[model samples]
Target: MSVELWAQPAMMSDPAPEQMMEHILKRVGDIPPLPVVATKILSMVNDPDLEVDDLVSVIQKDQGLTAKILRVSNSAFFGLCRTITTVKEAVVTLGLNNIRNQVIALCARSMLETRAEGYALEAGGLWEHSLGTAFCAERLSSTLGLKGTADQVFVGGLLHDIGKSILSYYVATRFQPILRLVDGEGLTFVEAETQELGFDHAEIGARVALRWNLPEALVDMIAHHHGPSRESKNRTQVCIVHVADAIASMLGLGLGVGGLENRIDDEAIAHLGVDDQVVQDVMVHMSSIGDLRAHIGIN
Candidate 1:
């Protein structure tokens, strides 16, 4: 959704944070819609009978996106023996799932690239953090023997903090208080947000996903990425993103104001069956990748 959907809170001598959150929710309609191509790709990816040619046709509809797909297909990350010169060839070579993720990343780049000054993130900082989390989540998924869900976990990690983008305006207004709580009271970012704003970014992010008509599994992951949700049916995905976020923060990829203050959910790690060895392997792999921005086309 577009940043325009972030409604300014009403001017009042003393308005409750709950009231402010209600206003924000009502204005969700003002958010920009997802690119039609991205939405179509998401739908097709979930279809059991999706055809490669059908996906190729959809990618071809946008020449720029098609080129991006081909470029990523040939990037050093893929380690292709030859260049992929066409959408059909890229889809066949990279597989539909990888193509779908690339499209999602491209579509989300604009929105995620915005500077979240309220959260103390400089321009492109949030994007860098999100992309790092996407990579980490995908790797974690594979390491946990859930390779089939690597792409889905990547999307979950990519959009985990999206609520911050929407709530940034209000956060800017409440920044001082939030910071005070974080520094003085030793509260986590989510705790501070809930105490000062009557809601956390995770909750807001879930609403955003619902507004976009995203799949329920994705919505749940975005909603509970910080920890497990009793309401979430896909606990594994939620845990994957949760652990991935912790890993990203630990790596200091783009840790803004309260980014480093987050705690790793021990239960989530255990639930995903992630051991110390897995964590070690992920850290080493991340270091070896070097300049993830280039691999993800952020630059």
Candidate 2:
């Protein structure tokens, strides 16, 4: 609240989560908007009674989106022998949910491809990392036998770091010291954030997602991803996303300002039942991950 608080020295610990969340919400405003097609598709698909005709009509409105969906369906990722020529055909073949997730993924690329200089993420770096995490989450969810759609988990992973975009301008100007602290001063990213900015990026990102009216489960994952121990409902989903992010960060797919300390979350690992063997399996499948990542066009 005071100038002194902004200049406070780095401490070994984090602040109370509630205080941090409040400050981030009060300080940040007017996040970038989701693409019109993405917003409309999210609204349509989320409606329980919406029919396939309704989805086809909406996809028809955006000619580019229709083509992209068809392309994605026929791509090696989906592995269909037949071509998907029409929006309705793709929806029928790929299923409504997978089509919806691809639309979101396409829109997210346009939204996040700009480099956020403040966080030291190059143009497209955040997009690539987000996509990789989403891919990882989808695989992990299937492995865990989770109840929800893997496509939804993939979308959650894609937008998990939307808050980084919200604070890019501030990080460029007011919080440059935070970056220096994290790198040269041997501080954890969260610790550096608390010392220099009076808050951390994860909470800031969570607030941005909340403002966008994303599902509360997603908002919770973005908010408490770093503090998975605090998450209650959908803890497995949150942990999936949390560990996915750590793995993405470690793989150097989109190394942002957050360094290697952003490695895998041990708590999330234990929470999700991901053990040494699972990690090895994921690594063995890295080539498959790369193929999927490339197909998503986040590269």
Highest lDDT: which candidate? 1
Question: Candidate 2 local accuracy as lDDT?
Answer: 0.68
TM-score, prediction 1: 0.89
RMSD of each: 2.6, 6.6
Assess each prediction's global lDDT (C-alpha) against the native: 0.81, 0.68
lDDT of 2 by residue, 134-189 (tens): 87777777777763546556777888877676556555654567767867988887
What is the clash count of model 2?
A: 1
Q: How far in Å is the alpha carbon of 273 misplaced in model 2?
A: 1.3
Clashing residue pairs, backbone N/CA/C < 3 A, model 1: 2-32
Candidate 1 lDDT, 1-299, residue by residue in tens? 44724546465655787677667778776767677788777666457678888988888898888777777788877778898889888878877776787889888887787878778887788888898898999999888889867877888888888887888877888888988898899888778878998888889989878878888878988999877865678888888888888889889977987778666688887787888899888888788888876666435
Which candidate wins on TM-score?
1
Error of 2 at 276 (Å): 1.1
Distance (Å) between predicted and true CA of 292, model 1? Answer: 1.7
